[model samples]
Target: MEGRQLQQVLNPQRLKALQEWMQKSSITLTQVNGQRKYGGPPPGWQGPVPGPGCEVFISQIPRDVYEDRLIPLFQSVGIIYEFRLMMNFSGQNRGFAYAKYGDPVTASTAVMTLHHYRLPDGGCLTVRKSTEKRQLRLGDLPTNINQVKLLTLLRMVSDGVEDVMLKMAGPKGREVVALVNYSSHYAASMAKKVLMQAFKKHCGISITVKWTSFSKSKHVSETEQEDGTSTPPGLNPFPKPSISPPHLHPQPFLHNVPAHPPLQSSFSAVGGPAGPPRDEMKPQGPVNCDTVSLLQWMCEVHRLGTPQYEIRYHHASSDGFLCFSYEVLIPCFLIPLYGVIQILPGPSAQATKEEVYRAVAELVIQTICKVSSLRPF
Candidate 1:
């Protein structure tokens, strides 16, 4: 079947599979006169032809200039397909504009020569390929899309992905840029349609997918690099929260508990007890249970240093003379301790290890007095 006939017969699934190999590529047909005597206005040196009917973006124009200014400047050389001054939400000119010339010859000449010219109001004009290639193409896609990924997605949407390329700006890792390339205009149009409705969230930033004509130098191949490296952690989505040393019962063990009770995962389960053996000090029962292992895993995944943790048990009947000591509490117990300390009285929270310990001990001592023998652990 020819292109259009094949398109009709294939079901969506079959159409999807063929799309990869049959990716979109722009076909530039140079219009000709039948008798061969057709000529060129070919006066000065104009660069490569943009291939008939391509569009170019013209920007940095004086807002006051209207259609009267645009028609003549562009029509003087080649056919003026259309001209538009990009506007803002209020319909005011954005200072930049876009224009489509009839064919490659006109578009290229405008980009190379007219680019540096000054508009009537002395505004410098720069002509580039527009991001709105969707006007002349196909596919549905979001605007803030990752260029490389967009091509891959376009293949899934339609058989029109013309080409895929990434552009990098700035220095190496800090480069700020967007990916761009072409697709059969149809493919480009479809991508724009799909992405606007469905693309994954990236750092809470929305995806944007559009058309581009940057098939040259600024165009990047996957292998090319201007010094790229891994992005630093924490700045990205869902970084593991770091449980700093301040959160832990600094001294994992004290006179309160005898054994550090190696939890079996973290090597930081260092320095045994301060007093006597765990059993001798307090009629020790099973110090660790199956749950400790699970807790250890959570700590590792959450980056909570388990071995440096503690759990302190105290005598319930100490009156106001209650004294408590650091006994290396696991992150499970310590995290809540942080909350408890939040509403704690003033002078007690001195931001020092001694102050925190003192405050926690004081709160526990007072809160526990109201409790009976079965103290809430």
Candidate 2:
């Protein structure tokens, strides 16, 4: 039976046989940093680097399943540009992998044909389009930092830093932010884990590292139109500037919200009227409030000065979600509020910032609403 054969193939004693099977099949896998990769574009023919939507995310793989089975199955759809299987120290797969093809059409075909396909062990595979994120947003940097210097410093600390773009941050443009593109998502992820500590130790400057949003509005719009679903409004209030300066772009300005806005109106929209009485009211769901508006309302009600955001760390998971460890400083409280949040990957820098802000606002509102003492009006 297929199941019995699979069990035999995966037995510890059969690893040599598996390797020999791979060799006989002309499949070469190289291990690197907890992943086993086949073909940096595949050994055979020449073509351009795979673009967006050319990769399919595969999950629900049986730990015993290796490329010897997966690669050939995928190749039945089309030529595989590359394949990577996440690995563990115990010599088994991490239950997920990515398969890239020569084009988006082929990737789509692989997803259509292989998704939910049953394995010999009765496990089904989950396959879908990959976002292919390869950029990191570095925030709270010095305004004087230049692209060349940043690229140099990043290279000293991380690998696959292909390009760096500088942007002005803060209302008066007093701070700088950098958008760093890596050769691959894996490289960017590894760099993100180390860049925060590396910068603090080497340059004595603390920085916020997060995945940069790559906009997918065009594709989303097309899909929505086909489904006859209405498009959502843009979360960011400010319009993007018409032009970017050389390698520098403008950062999201959080100070644009009026400082003296009536707090009652804001709370009314989120829950009921703002004040001590409203403290008991639970937010219906995610507060439909933007970060700037929420911060303004918080400062006005609590008498706390402008809050500070310090992203301690952030990383994108294989499932296309970004997780962040962040701190928010309230003037009235000596210690900053620490928490973690997960959000879907966004399409642009501004969109991503808005998502973080909205998430933080929801957290703040939920927290204060639960603890009346924290309101201290």
| Per-model TM-score on C-alpha atoms | 0.28, 0.52
The alpha-carbon lDDT assigned to residue 26 of candidate 2 equals 80
lDDT by residue (tens digit), candidate 1, 120-150: 6567766644333322122233335476675
In angstroms, give how far residue 339 of model 2 lies from its true place: 36
Candidate 2 stretches with Cα past 4 Å from truth are 1-10, 13-17, 156-159, 168-175, 204-206, 214-377
**Which candidate number has the best TM-score?**
2
Give the distance in Å from residue 285's predicted Cα in candidate 2 to where it truly belongs.
50
